[model samples]
Each structure stands twice: as C-alpha cells, then as structure tokens.
Target: MTGLRPDTGRQAGTMLIVFGVVLLVSSLVVSAALAPSVGAAGNDGTPQTLVGSQGGGPGLHESGSVYLLDGKETKWKAAETDSYFDVTMLDNGSVATGFMDSGYEDCEPYESPCTHTGFRILEPTDDGGAEIVYEYSFPVRTRSNSEVHDVELLDSGEFLVSDMEYERIFTVKNGEVTWQWNASSMYDAPADPTTTDWLHINDVDALSEDRYLVSVRNANQLVVIERGEGVVEVINKDENGDGTGDPEVLLQQHNPQWLNNGSVLVADSHNDRIVELHRNNTTDEWEVAWAVYEAEGVPFSWPRDADRLANGNTLITDSLNQRVVEVNESGMTVWSYKTPYVPYEAERLPEGETVGATTYAVNEDATVYGNGDVPVLSLLLILFQTGIQVPFWFTELHVGVTLVSLTMTIAGTVLIVRDR
Candidate 1:
C-alpha cells in the first residue's frame, strides 16, 4: 500500500477542516429552523403569570430575571440583578423573591469579588418598571448553586428562607435569623458543608405556624420540620435507613406544594414529570396519586416547578424547554408562554399555588418522551455543563452533525501534524 505524501496529507487535512466548519454552521441553521413557535398555543385565558429564571445557565447569572407575562406579552420585568429564584406576589402588591448579585466587599474567609444571596421585595412603578424597595442579602464564597432558592413572607413579619450555602432552613426577621434547621443533623455531613453542594436544601415553606416543609434535593427527599422539634416526617424516607432517600419516589425534586387534603405536588426534576403524591392513611406510605409525563406532544425536559391552580389546572415550568405550560387533568396543553430563558418557578396570580388539585389516577403505561437522544453529547452539554444549553429542537440530525464535526476536526489536526 502506498503512503500519502506530505503534500497530499496536508491537502486532506485542509479539506477535513473545511468540512467540519461547514457542518457546524449548517447544524446551527437547522436548529434555528426547527425552533418552536414562541407564543401561546391556545386561548386558555392567561392569568397574570409570574416567572423566576435561575439565571441563563450555570455561572451566567447575569442573564437571570423575574418577569410578568400577560398572555405571552411581558407586562413588567425585574432584570437588574445577577440571578433570581422563587417569586411570590405579596398581599400589599409587592413581590418577594430570592436573588443573587456579585460585587461585595465583605467576603470574609473567601476573598474579593464574592456573591450575595438573599431576598428582595420589589414594587411596581407606574412606568411599567419595577424597583427593589427592600433587601436582606448576605455574601457567600461562590455563586454556583449557593444562592437562596426560596423565600416566603411569614405572617409573623418574618421571612422564611432556604439557605443552600449552609444547607439549612431558617427564618429571618428584620435581618436576624430567628430560627434555623440544619440538614447536617440528619444527613452525613461533609467536612465543610459550604465548600460543596451537600444536601442542597433549596426550598422551605410554612405549612402552619409550627410546621414547615423542606426540600432536601440532593437527598431525594422532602422533610417536615416543626419549630421546636426536628424532622417530624420525611417523604421518600430511606428504606435501608441509610439517610439517602428513596429516589424511586421523588428523585431530586424541587418546589413541592403541600396540598390541603394531605397530599403533595412536586416537580420531579430528574424524572422529567410533575408528580402528586398522596399519603396512604392506612399504610402510612406516600404513593404517586397523579403524574403527567408529556404535554404539547413532547415529553418534559428538566421541569422544575408545577403549581396546581384553583381551577383544576396545573401550571408547569418546563425548564429545558424554556416555556411554561398550563395543562388540564387529561395532560393536554391549554395555554403556554415561551420564556426567554430556563425558568425555575412560576405562579399564576389571584389564586397562585393554593392547596387544590382534583384526584388523579396514576397511569404507569403512559408513553413518555424527553430531549432527543444524543447520548455522548447530551451528557457533556445538557447533563454536565451548567452554562451550556441544548435546544429543544436538538434532534438526531444535530447530534450527527456534532459528532461528525468533532471527528473531522480531530482527524484534521492529526493529519496536519504528521505532514508537519
């Protein structure tokens, strides 16, 4: 067999590089051509929906914002911060939300250029703008996965906050932590909790004056802690008593809603579905009472929030899909709004996330669909990197383009090196 001469190899390498560039450019064009229509699908009466985006992606918190939509039209927006999480409109017409911002002097043991994570109250202006009227935030070491994700204004004039930095849930009254519950008391603690995302206790809600619901996301469990007592109950409690919860039940859930009838609604993020769990009074077990795997003819991709409206409809924040959809009990998309970025939580006002849901029978045989299969690329882009984003239209064609481009680029470099 005759070997390729240096000049031939160099020519082959150049041709391969050109092919890789062309494929990449063509893939982007195809992705844009297949993008979903960004508007409401049907007239289900858009009821003043508020959305909280967890920044654009990973460390790109500057792309985050809290905005209001009236039937796909933005009414007012609060985008002057780095990142935003849970959002709720207070009784006095002010919005209370969790936020993160960079640039602080007091980083303490960390260093300069730290981030501050806490809550802010925004008041709407007459000019269709919003202003931060009050804020209660503190500096932290890092920005990624270290912000307060949920905040609830208690009736006691205190703010219930989920502190992910220290893996705890506490209430702050006038800037002082009135009460706190640490997850290390239950889970196996790391050497220093703040250095890594351990429990990732992202949400805490007051069920009553003494009772609270805490979402321990990394542990795949939700906990009910009383003011005086520790964990009174644990949903998805471990079977072998290892403290690592049962993932088959919840699986890295977020923003769980405690229903009035002793049930719980959860955004099962890793599972890509919205599940409602009802506690069995007889067996003392939580079972999947209702679950919806798909809407608008597509399976959910990293859904982070689901709020059951008073009108028997469920509003879902389909995170990776970059849209919020309201679905009926039959799993049909009634109304939808395309968000500018991946949203963490959403609420439809006047009767936001009240304790209401019609009982639904679980359908185990229901077909489910998720983001298109691009196994190797998916793990790298969608699963690992927090800053990178994969479009909903990223189908097998895009996957093929990406794989071929990468191979050609690497092969071209090798061929050129041999010629040199």
Candidate 2:
C-alpha cells in the first residue's frame, strides 16, 4: 500500500507483477552504472565492522575478509584462473574447485564456452607461498569431463565431482577420476540422458561413504544415490505418519542436504521453499519437517543454494535477487548479506571461528563470530553487493540500493498483513 492504491487493488496487483519484470530489467542497467562505487564493502572509509576480517598469520593472512572473485581483493591471490566457480576445503586444510576458464558474470557469453577446469590450492608452503597440489582437466565431451563443478571429499581421500554438461558424477582420488555415475545408468540407460537436462548440477554432498545428496536443477530432483556395487533406489517421502507414501511430496529440489539428525533437507528452488524431507513412521513414505518460502514464510524470489553448518545456521544463496542469508532452524533470518557475481554459491571458511581466516593476506583476529564472519554460498543479500565499491561519498548509492530493496521488505509486509 505504500506505493499503491487500494481502490484498485486487483488492478494494482497485475501491474505489480509486470512491474517486477521491468524492475528486473532496470536493475542491470542502474546497478551496473553504479557498480564500481558499490562492488564490495571494502574499508568503507570509516571501517565498517565486516564480520569476516582476517585473523592474521603468514600464508594465512586472509581471516575475516571476503573476496569479490575479480582477482583484485587482496584476500585471494589469484596467481591464475579467471574466476572461481566452486570451492571446498580438504581435511588437510587445503582447498579445491572447478575453476572456470573466464570471469563468470550472469553467464558466459553464448560464443565463448568457458571450459570448467579442476584445480587445488595448498596453503602454508615453505617460503610462505601457496602450492598447487594438482591441476587437472576434464574431457570436453566425456561423461565426467569439461566442467567438474562441485566436489565432495569422501573420508577415503577421494572426492565426488559433479559434471555439469555431462550429466554425470565422477570420483577423484588424488586428482584422477577413478569412478563415475552417469544419469543414463541411473535412469534405465536411455541413449540420451540429456532428456532430464538437469542443467545445473549445483551441489553434491556425502550422505555416507557410498551415498550422496545431489541437486539436479531441471528434473527438480534431489536424489539420494546408493553406491553399493550397483544399486539405484528412489527414497520416497511418506507424508502420512503411517510409514507409507501416505501423502504429500516433501520437496521438488534444487539443492538437498542430509541434516545432522539424518533427516533430509531439500531446497525447492522453483517453488522457492526449503522443505525438510524425511522418513515417516511407516517404511515407504517421508514427511516435510518444515518448509521456508513464500508459501511457508521467507517468500524468496529465487532461492538458489543453501547449506547447513554445524552451528545450526543455514547459509542460503538467494540467487536471482542476489543475496545470501543465514537463517536459524526456526526460519528466522539471523545474519544476512549479499554480494555480486551472483556470489551464486559459498563454501564455509576453512576453519570454525577459532580457525585463522585471512583477508587479502592481512592478519587480524581480534574477534570470532563463527560463520558470521564468513560468506556466501552465492548472490549476496542485495543486488548492489556486487560492483565498484569505494570508501567515501556513498550517499547516493546507498539511497538507490535502499529504494530498490524496499521491494523485498514491502512484499514481506504485504504477506504478513494479508495473513492476519
């Protein structure tokens, strides 16, 4: 109502949907124009309290700092690679990722096929230099080639990497592919497994040594695959307490996770809800422990990716709108922030708050705030979080970004008021 007339509420509602589209178009134009002055909140001229500042140390001077992936921020020394696609930490405190061939913004140009490359970075080298444990390339057309997007390190020193274009999952041991899971095999071996087009293989996590919780975008399927010899069974959710496929489907997922209690968590991106998928009292069904979305609560425009930390906070990438939110188990957003490059995805800082994290090689560990200091599964909180950021004279940029974000705040208000 702040920007509308109730006299024509229905008419106004129709216009608002159209307004969303126009606003989206204008977003790129206006936001890009203000990019440089608003890229990352660095220094802020007045030393704003950034949660993730470096704790300080040699070769590990990147404590509380979060980098913008532009190869600039001092936090990550990009000796090579254009932009970082995905990143995960190893048990030895090292890191690895599917390094994109070029800087990722929106998406790669149609003509330039940015090949997905695989590489690893080892820290605390002898001369204060970071060493490369291994850098390998995937086959362009093979089932597990081209882009090795997400990697999950198994307890046995091997890792499972999702192959985006290939519609497959490969297991890597010391930088070599030793095993693979193709969609065709999982789906009764159709010649063209691309039917599912599960376009974005965003996340993969270990349910156990042999099973995984994989996020397949197109099929909207969150599959739990059993890797015992050759086993493929669909774990159905039972909505009724009777332990059978009693009722509703808990999720249509974009990202799914297994909780500490063995209950499954599914990020239903299309429906914009994070539904808890778990077994019911009966043997054949599952129930939705909880759901967070427009219908349930958060009313997210596009909730892309999410992860659960040991500390009970869930890091979610609110992609299209460009924000990352840390929500409590009760669905209350606790610490929230957004960044550019879609910040599309984020990995937990290597260590817990007690672990030393660096920002551009600078060391300063005065305070510890757990995942509060770290960031990003992807698109940071506000769309403006990405762009050319400067320290002073931020009056205009702040106002503009604020106005745009009012849309988000208002939607929530509308929902609340309407509910009552």
Best by TM-score: 1
lDDT of 1 at 33: 78
> Model 2 Cα displacement at 348 (Å)?
3.6
Candidate number of the best lDDT = 1
Instruction: Evaluate all candidate structures by whole-model CA lDDT and list the values in order.
Output: 0.81, 0.47
| Candidate 1, position 378, lDDT | 53
lDDT of 1 by residue, 1-420 (tens): 988875888889989989998989888887687665644576635679988887676655767788888767788888867889999999987889998888887777768878899999998888887899999988887888788999998899999999989999999998899999888888899998889988888888788877899999998999999988999998887888777677767878899988854588899887778888878777887877777876775567778899888888889998877789888877778888777777889999976666544545543332223332212325544642246666666645676688889899899988988988
> How would you encode candidate 2's per-residue C-alpha lDDT over 26-81 as one tens digit per residue?
66566556643222322223211111111122211112122322222224433344
RMSD of each: 3.1, 14.2
Query: What lDDT does model 2 reach?
Result: 0.47
Poorest lDDT segment (10 consecutive residues) of candidate 1: 366-375
TM-score for each prediction? 0.89, 0.55
Angstrom error of the Cα, residue 171, model 1: value is 1.1
